[model samples]
Target: MTVRTGDELPPLRIPITRTLIVAGALASRDYQDVHHDAEAAKEKGSPDIFMNILTTNGLVGRYITDHFGPRARLRKVAIRLGAPNYPGDEMVLTGQVTAVAEGTVEVAVTGRNGIGHHVTGKVTAELPTDGPGTGDAPGTGDAPGTGDAPGTGDGPGTGDARKRTTDSPATTDAPMTTPDTPR
Candidate 1:
């Protein structure tokens, strides 16, 4: 069954890509060519640039919460970006149930490109049960099923943090950093 707000989820996965990287950076106003310019990327010590960690975490949340429709309210999301993602590398976003409480479900999350992971984190979101309910979330000021988030979510919780996927590449011909191929 689809987990509602505050309901722990089994797990989820997402693929990263050049398009995702570009779309994320553009949407977030992070106009760093290092994220879009292959030349600038190489100059900055990278291979074809990558998606900022902020969008990575945001997308991860999207992957899980979207599965449950509008009823899911994002509570908290945290992450760390690891390796750079090139055009060909496939990134896998995955997470498992961590906890559920007071209309909120927490999930530990992680995302790894073929070279290595680019985001590892946690997220909390409101999940409504199938029974009769107030449809109001503890921190969602507007109400449940609404895009508006309140209290903890309305403040410093709206946006995700971002960082270069890696200080160096992690693959053969990475053109910047050392390869971190799985052991």
Candidate 2:
């Protein structure tokens, strides 16, 4: 994972279904009516049940981790919501690497839907400095199927959240920022 400033991550498209909105709200223990009950949302002056911040946050984290590999740890995620995600729409998440340090990377992210920008934020994450394919190296203790790991994943989401599709090319770019060097 040689990351550099201006490197663009592959876009991930998430369908904003009613099931997803409700399930995410339920899974996150957010019982807000606006996130699940369409009638309640309508009563609150909304056109339909909308996605909650927690659900969007999880999706954002998933987007970054999916692109950076599961070994990546998100240090900070600062985001603001713009458009309300309705049941029939989809959100496309895109990111650009903004900074790269010794073992850290920062990405500027945007999630756009039919109504416009659904979410926008910056994510700071830590990556293994040993480079790509080192996530399963000896002593990492994060090897797949280790312990009660629930076995290997069949791609991104399974059992929770909507199944998202990724349209990514072989997207990683060469490292322009050197380790411990100022950007």
Q: On a 0 to 100 scale, what is the lDDT of residue 26 in model 1?
A: 90
Residue by residue across 63-175, what tens digits does model 2's lDDT show?
Answer: 98888766666667899999999999999999999877656778999999999999999887766554333342334454555431453453223431133222221333457
User: Can you write out model 1's per-residue Cα lDDT over 32-150, one digit (the tens) per residue?
Assistant: 99878889998887767877766776788776665534455565666777787667677766666655444445667777777877778877665554443223324333344443344
After superposition on all CA atoms, how large is the RMSD of candidate 2? 9.7
TM for every model, in the order presented, reads 0.64, 0.75
Q: Which candidate leads in TM-score? A: 2
Q: lDDT per model, in order?
A: 0.58, 0.76
Candidate 2 residues lying further than 4 Å off, grouped into runs, are: 131-183
**Number of backbone collisions per candidate:** 13, 1
Looking at model 2, residue 59 earns an lDDT score of 98
Best by lDDT: 2
